[model samples]
Target: MIKIDELREGFGSFWGSVSEGWDRLRHTAAGALTRFKPGEQTALPDRGQIDDPLHFPAQSWSMLGGDVFEDEQRLVVRIEAPGMEKDNFAIEISGDTLVVRGEKRFEGETTEGRWRVLQCAYGAFQRTVPLPAAVRGDEAKASYRNGVLKIDLPKVQPGKPTSVNIKVD
Candidate 1:
């Protein structure tokens, strides 16, 4: 017969292991974890006849990596978000952060059998990057090509200092 305290200890150890693994995965694959939600009907494969070999949950995370470069004149931001049209992306500057939101639509292939593995992530997602210096939001320029979104934001120029003359009383 096993003691009650020993059983409790065993369960605690099991939970601790699970929590530790999750923490490791989260840190190791930070860029590969883009939270997503179900979008239109065509956004995801037909779950009724599809099979997941990796046993991934219905709600899967995607990877949307980005980079920021700054110079004396302007700041440039580049984000990788494939499988989306140019009109689908919406860029905005909120305070000192640059927010990018878009939806990746799914274009179903002409196949007969059920899908065996679905690794690509679909649906609506938003990514934000913090800006180092103040920028001219109204003068921002953006372009998308070959699955990359690029934005150029001009930095705000400082005003000139004015000198004042004092008279002795």
Candidate 2:
């Protein structure tokens, strides 16, 4: 017999895969749109005209993607953050939420010709992921390597209730 927890897990996995696929498709479409005729112009602002380094246009931004899964004793989370260093990320677990925040700074490039296309996103981004089960935040471990951030959180074990005897007052 299939249990409810099993069904839930199956659905969660299915949805996560779908969401990741959709994000990839959207990014591909946006990149393709930037390769139009040079003479044809849109209302979008030129990268050179933007004075503020933090200003990221809506159409040019992309969010970080990740996956979460649990093993027998640990809950693991892996996030894709390409071109970022270890010091660039700030991760915290508050209550039942795991918050990952970071900024991908734009590296200025000096080229003789003007930029014809710019699709990479560079700015501050935050992603909050809810824990599937209770975990010990204090004992959590994290590591970043090869543009991927991996976190391992120890799962909390349920303990037996303790009964206290009351003395007559």
Best by lDDT: 1
Question: Worst 10-residue stretch by lDDT in candidate 2?
Answer: 32-41
lDDT of 1 by residue, 47-76 (tens): 775787663434767878778887778889
After superposition, candidate 2 runs with Cα above 4 Å error: 1-46, 49-60, 158-169
TM-score of each: 0.71, 0.59
Across 108-142, the per-residue lDDT of candidate 2 in tens digits comes to 55655554555666556667777877889899999
Candidate 1 ranges beyond 4 A from true positions? 1-32, 53-58, 158-169
Worst 10 residues of 1 by lDDT: 155-164
In terms of TM-score, the best-performing candidate is 1
Give the whole-model CA lDDT for all candidates, comma-separated: 0.80, 0.71
What lDDT does model 2 reach? 0.71
